[model samples]
Target: MHQPNYIILQCYGYEAVFLECAYALMSLSRLYKPEELTNTEIWVYTDKPEWFDRFADCPLPLHFRKMDAALIKQWRGDIDFVHRIKIELLLDFTETRTGNILYADTDMVFLQKLDDVWNGLAPGELYMHMQEGKISEKGNPLFRKLDTFLRSGKAIKTEGTPLYDLYMWNAGILGFHSSHRELLQKALEYTDSEHPKFPKHIIEQFAFSIQFGSKGNIKSALPYALHYWNMKELRQIIASFLQYFDGKPWADLVRYSSLLQPYILVTEKNMFLQNRSFTEKVLNKKWVPAMPNWELLEKQI
Candidate 1:
């Protein structure tokens, strides 16, 4: 029998994001053995359910929680933070469901079977994308600024956890049990308080990092999944693919999408940054060949 757990995602807004959500769901099916989702339900909290009509006959049960404008606006709250909605949506579902909950960003893909990750989640532990170091570090200049900003106000909310000392984990993936749902509220609180002052995008991410890490044993989900947030420019390419295969059968999309190697793309982007030739960096205002030729992306590597 399947485990009474859940893997959920929230996708709303424009066409590109919706397609990315579709790609994320499709990646789950590309796993070995039972084609993934063998033990859990995949709940997509989205505004456009009809956009996912292609998944009607999926083997595992798919749940759609309809999200309207007002609900989304409410989730954003007074802070108007876009990422805040992620915590809110997860909190809302945990209210009714009682099992292990894994929340993922739309811009992510699975690297292994769902069981690989599922086996790691339990009641007492929490999970995020990966550890991104502390705020006081010089790795990211903005985070250094955040360290100064939070330190001045003595704004560390959670007990025993100092803001400067805490590690800022990527909030792309969150794993927890219904028993620990209260941490999501703390995450929202941290986001609302710091975002108005810092006004940086990583505020919500740090908030989740703070609360979830402080209160529970936070684990990294990077071993089983890869979040392609750095390569967001690829969204337009995904949009083109969606347009070309708009009404095609689900199997065709799956086969074609299997060619996507987000980790390799990220590696290539990093390598370019490190080994940027003088012509590419200084002389050529307009660069030469596009890495991983898009013309034949879906057809083959």
Candidate 2:
């Protein structure tokens, strides 16, 4: 019944979705006794504390920690600048827990209590979402590089080969016990390395997948978490959850003790950088809603 400390990394523009996921987790936490979740700490690692004011009225028990923008801006690597902050934050958690760490992404919504995963946690085994592709999966430039490396004698792919699966585990949800500092540190180093000249996409994720993949010590195929890629997929999952609760309302859904974890286990955050106008122009965007008309409310009347 060790208390679990869940860490969430976020910044401003995502305040809307971030608050949604946070409250969902808090609501889910009500299902278990406080002792069951010893020291349930929600570390909101952010670069902007002002955003805390927006969520100040939220019902979740949140602890805010700000990061120095100056320190992060100078970091070099293929990992997204924001992701680097997350990695660094993990280091902080490591010192406190020594090994017990459950990392989650802000975009995720939890559907079930994670006690199953926590109770099932192995001492030395790290839990990561299994990559849906082999190393040779097309559409990713990294695969091309791995292929070239394999052909160049730098890597060998034989039967039972470690590189055979070559799957890239999603970083959205990662669970690693303490005492794996060496591996985590190595991952950080590999990610920091600019050599081998890898592609810029999913850099940290690719490195982490390789580090864990080569060791062959990962806990795969667990029904612990799901990663939704975009708003469309996210909506579908939410719809399914809503249906599962017998078409319950969103606010009422919060009352279902069994529905909290799944609703809060979100892993992917949408970085809304694209201009809304650009997206609107690309598609006629004629997906009209069949719900209550809000246009009348915007009228001059």
Candidate 3:
């Protein structure tokens, strides 16, 4: 199985950020064999290598590439769009390396083994987490706003890509051959041109979507990885878990993380979408996406 090198672009700052990546990384330790990992490179870009000292023995051999404050600021580029760092990193990787590159966000957790996931991608294809839908059709309040803005013919400088029909793929997982580096540049250009006009946080995501769509074979990485972008409450849960798991070995962390499910995938999220009476649907709202509570989750662990 020929899996590409993986990149996790994160700077050391918040403890929740570290815990988010740490939990996601444990998914690797649990799924891949030691020998398989020996040949694979998991490049972790961060300012603090010591933050992950306890996870040193993980089967996924983490190679730390330090990023200082100035470098990170530069990567954010002139527009100061934070997500642009990912494109810059990909471009930087292609300058020196020739293999395939798989860039994942800190919020993602792998559901399949790395080799098995790699097997599913076609040669010369690109990937994002999954297709959310065309912006014109999406029911999301934010997408609705963007759709209205696009319909008014504001930024016609997007080089004739169908702004309304562009699908908003979640940018949590990106896989592409290193040779396709030019697309990243185009994505950056799209971002720079559109962001000043629209000023939404999702411009970078849509930019990558548009550029990669030009390749004609962008697959969904949803089956292999879960991007818990909507699970905002998880910060507290992860913090509690990190405190509980302090000083534990990598194997122990892997064991528990393997059992842990993304709260967004649980039944509570679905129950909210269930059919309801006209008045009840208008007046009554659900309190939560009820993941297993900490007490119950601890018992399960």
Candidate 4:
């Protein structure tokens, strides 16, 4: 039998936001109806372990960990936060012996069953957030500036380093086999390298792009979940989304603004929930993979 598992990265905070994120995920869990439903293992990595102990008797097998917030504060590299999450996954994967894994962000609600995703895993292949555009695609004005910085000869360098570029990805929900251990190693190398300053989220994304290469090993996924508010283009995308949503049922927003959503999804949980519900509506009753490459206002790196 194919064993399935779920992982989530979280931190304790205001009750409403936590409830919103948990509800969205639990709602998705209810939809999947997995056999291990009574014993489905769910691992949560957080700085606040106490927040999750309340569910000690729940059907979902819950594992919790308290992470050092200082690493995030001091290094703040692109892959730092997620790299830690991946490490948590790596360690848990070794310990739990779960054969298949589905990684999700806490703030998304699943609209359809994920059995297909679980069944689709191929040997040696792992699920990754699809890059929005082609490799050769040049980024927008702000991103161009970021590229300039990378090439400016001022970045921290290490041997075998490759200059990076790639599209954005909203990692709300992704499925992959536990077999792709090499991917995690490669991602860590990319994130740990010296840089003038630590790369934030984009570093891991860029590393993932390079790791997957042109074959697009991590093929695009139909929109399955929505990440809430991201900070990259906090000002513009919000305005554009309001315009894009334009009186449509809030659920239809992602279809219209998928290209811009990833950059804004991680910043605010409440906004993420509100917009995710709206985007879920127009997304072709099935998941719609996000658009890869498009001009977007860049953030300070």
lDDT winner:
1
* lDDT at residue 141 of model 1 (Cα atoms): 87
Best TM-score goes to which candidate?
1
RMSD, candidate 3, Å = 3.3
lDDT digits (tens) for residues 184-232 of candidate 4: 5675565576322544555555555555553345744445554443332
* Model 4: worst 10 consecutive residues (lDDT sum): 292-301
**Per-residue accuracy of model 1 over 159-212 as CA lDDT, tens digit each:** 565678778899898887787777888878878877888788898888888778
Q: Model 3: per-residue lDDT, tens digit, 1-301?
A: 6545555545466777788888888877777777866556788788888888876677676888787889889988888878888778777777877656778878778887755445444367788889888999966988998888777767654566668788888887888877778988888888887888888888888888888898786788887788887665666666766677677787877887754577545445555557556776788765454434545665676
Ranking 1 against 3 by lDDT, winner: 1
lDDT for model 1 comes to 0.77
Candidate 1 lDDT at 236 equals 67
The local lDDT score (0 to 100) that residue 228 gets in candidate 4 is 44
Q: TM-score of each candidate?
A: 0.87, 0.65, 0.86, 0.58
Full-model lDDT, candidate 4: 0.49
TM-score of 4: 0.58
Clashing pairs in 3: none
